[model samples]
Target: MSNLFVKDIVVSYSGLPIIDRLNISIPDHKITTIIGPNGCGKSTLLKTIARILKTDRGAVFLDGKAIQQLSTKKVAKRMAILPQSSEVPPGLTIFELVSYGRFPHQRGLGTLKLEDLKQIDWAIQVTGLSELKDRPVVALSGGQRQRVWIAMALAQDTDILILDEPTTYLDLAHQLDILLLLEKLNKEEERTIIMVLHDLNLASRFSHNMIAMKEGSIVAEGPPSKVMTSSTIQKVFDIDANLTICPFSTNPILHSYQLSGCTQDLLENANEG
Candidate 1:
């Protein structure tokens, strides 16, 4: 188990800061979800942890070692990342796409070794894509395609997995399926799973730790019950909402309402009256 520590990370694009002096630690062997509004730097932070994006200041440490000092292959062997979207190579089958995960382990000629085959098989099995291995990637539905991408990332066989909005473009069932798969991977396989998720309720349900960010800063980080409160939601998302115990699960559930433009003025006038 290796902890991911982002110490005062700062990320910028085109001279504009996106993640500003953010610090967070992702515990090993747990599922951590980052939830925020669009463009809140969730994806940016994930990419920095994965070493896909260079940090402008500070450092990302994996197991107490600076990630930037590690070789690309070594980093790939320790951390696997599934970006929000990936280009689908023309005419590639699911099996072929998943086999690409072996790139980090290849020596010469990029041939798949016995170990690679075993890993690919296990990844496909875990993702339930064994039947679709031969199917062309472009021909599958959005959910099926997303599963294939996840299978590829799993084939990397890393201790840490970072997924950027994996549930995007997935239907309700597929979203649950992916979340459950991640939970199983974390609980049974002892893998650290970190993902950027938009659905707050799903994040609360599936994650062992929740990180709520706003404007490149973390608003709250803790277990869902403590971090998903009405005050935190309002502060992070600027929504007036009611928090209630979920009927079936006993978890905190947020119910928000649309605030009419005149409602505030009317309420203020009534207060004065």
Candidate 2:
């Protein structure tokens, strides 16, 4: 399978390393989720690979070509990225926002052509935003706004989609809504997806591959069955967890979890002191 390869990448902020010599191969046409605790460089790695952030060393390779060497428009034609927090303009309508995705293909003044309109409409329909095409993005609910951003990405018509914490700031139902939409896109359009996810259970359920990281280093990467073990979770997250296999789906499920030591024991020790 084709892969997006990161070779010896190093990223630093203020002379302190965030990601050090990180090497990973993200398989094409599959949903790959990166899971880790906060400040673990998951978002930084995604940004570097998407060329939104400059790498201090090494490079990201897309299909054997260095991503940095490619023109911005060239890269945009092949991949689209939706970052964690995107600031929208004051009053851009959903249709207008989605239409902006066609900029890379436009020759003059960034005006939408006939094909652009078709693509924007398709993106809106697929994301269930057809009725709200004229709605101001700032006025929409969180989930609706998220879908609008996703529709904009879809309108880019790229084979690879990279999202940083796509489900952030949403209720459980809305989170599932976005994830299910991504699964459908992957299955039907064969879009290769890479994302940073905070929820382990949801990541395991939807990801074809999972990369677990800690302290800017990858601890484990493989199918969820191989990487989502009790030991691996403890090692990567430093949290005690029970890993159970679901009888029906056979997927690894995180049972009950807590701090490694008992609360009662801590209280007893405190009283003794």
Candidate 3:
């Protein structure tokens, strides 16, 4: 499968730029997490990469072609995105919702072909929602609902999955529930997983690669040990942090953090830069 990457891309919102000529290549079959402070363009980058938002300049290339040049159905077959917030119509059954993912693969009046049923069944089974597939999505817990959405994406049968803040609004345990599922998808299915995450610790623990952004620019990008340094944390979020290796995973962990003394000054300097 071809990898997704952006080159010198500029993205704007409401006449203001959020990402300025940024570039990055997503490694195939790996879990990459984008981390940054609020308003730092993490979600903007993900949306642009997923083709949910347009870029003002340069290109987002997926499957070795400029994404904008491809049709929606063509793109959907190669990559799937789970946005930060999705509104599900009330009373929709989990099976019904996941069935929507088959739309990209549908043809000739959108009939549910045998292949479509197989994929849907696989998605529901892997997400551990087999028994609840007939239940209404509105009746499920937050974690279960998240799994339902993931099942929808999985049903898409794409090589790449881009998620914006996948763990937002989820409690601590549910957060792991989602991330662990993503990890499993990467390791077992060899799917490329990219996401925006606010929780630094979880991101560090789960991500094979991490990108740290500050004010619309990347401050650092690498494996957890390289990107989760005290300097990068302070520069990106204006928070002084203590870092150590996670003995179990051998990834860097944020031991503790507090506001940096030069928070205001760093912000001012970065804005000026």
Candidate 4:
């Protein structure tokens, strides 16, 4: 089990800060979700943790060791990240795409090892893509293509998995399927899963811990019950909404109101009256 800690980190682009002195800790072998409005630096934070984006200030520590000090190959062996979008080769087969995940583990000029084969098989099985293993990546549906990308990440066999908007284009069923797969990986395989999610309800249901950000800073973080409050949502999103507890789970459910013409006029009249 390895813990990821971000200490007072700040990320900037073109001399403008996007992540401002943020501190966060992701527990080992748990599923953590980051939620916020667009451009709130959720993806930026995840990228920094994965070492894709270099931090201008502070440090990211994995298992108490500074991540910057580690070599790229070493970091790749310990952590795998699936960015929001991936570049697909025009004629690459699923197996070829998934095999790229083994690059970090392989030695120079060595053949594919048994462990690699096993890992690739496991990734394919877990992502439910065994049937499409030989198919061309360009031929798969959007959901299937997403699953293939996930399979590639899984084939990396790293302890920490960072995903940015893994369910972006998927429909409801596929989104749930991916969430359940990540949950299983965390619980059964003892892997740490960190992801960025826009859907508040899905984040509350799937994540063991949640971090909510606003305007390049962390606003609230903890279990869904503690962080997903009406006040927090309103403050972060600038929207009036009702919060209720789900019947089965104690997570807060946000019901947003879309003010109509009549309702807006009535509210104004009430204030004037």
Candidate 5:
């Protein structure tokens, strides 16, 4: 299987550093989630790993080699990335949209070979989009549209898949649906899944490993039990998280949160006299 990691990577914009010399290794065939409050460089770290944005001072390695040295097509063959949003053409069909993923494997003239077609079909089937394969992209609901995007990634037939905030703009049920699909893919197919999420409860429930960031640095990195504690939550997000274990999921659940900043606490402490 292919391995992916970043070493001492610094990402900056206009001399302002957003991520400073951060190193992270993604375990093979596991779900790794990056979590942090706003502007903590979670997305920057992910973009660096996907090679979409260049790192100022360090390198991203894939299979023991620097990823930048590899051809774009070579990297695409091993990893697929879904950005926060995609612009769909007005009249694009689901099948047509998904077929674009096969471009990396296409030879001259870009004909869909039998293998590519079969892979596309399998992707649709696995994502539960078989019935909607011929539907127009503009007509599907939010959840279905998200599935279509993930289906497109699956068509790449890669060992690693990266998504940025896949649950955005989705309802609680739809969020669960998307995460469950990813869990299934990781467990059954052993695809390395890396994603960014804002929901601590969901991240705790779903991720095999969690990396929490603050001001371009990692506050915690380990299993959910290690990072979901009240102290870690306070350090990473500046909030005191009330944590409890769910009987069904057995993962840490976020019961609630209270602001940690002294300025935000205006209520007077009243002790029973």
Candidate 6:
């Protein structure tokens, strides 16, 4: 198992810091979720940790070696990152797209070795994409397309997987589908998973560790029981919410949110009049 560490990392945009001296440690073989409101630097931190964005200061280390010092192909062989959005090539089949993951492992002439072929097949099967292997990338539903991307990541055969909002733009059912698939990969295969998630409830239920951030700094970090308090929610998201234990997972769940200055008060006053 490989562990990732971020130490005092700073990422800036246009000379302003988006991720300001952020420090975090992702546990090996566990699911860690970064949660924060929009523009709070959750996704920026994830991308920086994955080495997609250059840090203005400090470093990210994978298994004690600075990530920037490693070769790109070397890092690709150990960790895979699925960004929030990607462009699909026209006329690319699902299998063809997934097979591209073997690029880092290919020798001269770029033939798929036997082990690589087996890994590709296993990735498709695990992601439930066998039936759609021959389908064109542009022809699939949103959920299926997301699975195709995950299959490609799985085909990379890396120990660590980093995703930015994997369930974004999906309906409730598709969101659950993607979360369940990631859960299975974490539990069954013991893969180290890190992602930025928008839904606090889903993050609480599925994550072994949750890091809550506000303005590029972490407000809390721990299991749901420790991190999902009402005070923390209010601090991190600027919303008043009630926290309760979930029945099935026994994790902290957000029971309700009270939006400040909502029109309900006006409606009540009008009714009284």
By TM-score, is 2 or 4 better?
Answer: 2
Candidate 2 — worst ten consecutive residues by lDDT sum? Answer: 258-267
Per-candidate count of clashing residue pairs (backbone under 3 Å): 0, 0, 0, 0, 0, 0
lDDT of each: 0.88, 0.91, 0.90, 0.87, 0.91, 0.90
List, residue by residue over 1-273, the lDDT tens digit for candidate 1: 346889998999889999999999998889999998888888898899889889999999987888999888998998899998887987999999999998898888998889999999999999999988998999988888889989999999898999999999989999999988998889899999999999887888888899999999999999889988877887887765567666645667665433324547766997999
TM-score of candidate 2 to 2 decimals: 0.94
Instruction: Give me the runs in candidate 1 sitting further than 4 Å from their true place.
Output: 246-250, 257-273
Once fitted onto the true fold, the runs of candidate 4 whose alpha carbons sit more than 4 angstroms away are: 247-249, 258-273
Return the lDDT, model 2, position 215.
Answer: 89
Please give, for residues 4-79, the per-residue lDDT of candidate 6 as tens digits: 8999998998898998888888989999999999999998899888898999899999978889999989999999
lDDT of 6 at 175: 96
Per-residue accuracy of model 2 over 1-273 as CA lDDT, tens digit each = 365899999998788899999999998889999999999999999999899888889999987988999899989989999999888897999999999888788886887889999999999999999999998999999999999999999999999999999999999999999999999999999999999999998898898999999989999999999889988988888877878876645779787676665745865887999
Model 4 pairs in collision? none
Cα lDDT tens digits, model 3, 150-267, are 9999999998998888888899988988998999999988999999999998999999899999888899999998998898888898888878888768888887776989656766
Cα RMSD (angstroms) for every candidate in the order listed: 3.3, 3.0, 5.4, 3.1, 2.3, 2.3
In terms of lDDT, model 1 sits at: 0.88
Q: What TM-score fits each model?
A: 0.92, 0.94, 0.93, 0.92, 0.94, 0.94
Candidate 1 lowest-lDDT run of ten: 254-263
**Clash total of candidate 5:** 0
Instruction: Provide the lDDT at 247 for model 2.
Output: 61
Clash pairs for candidate 5: none
- Pairs that collide, model 1: none
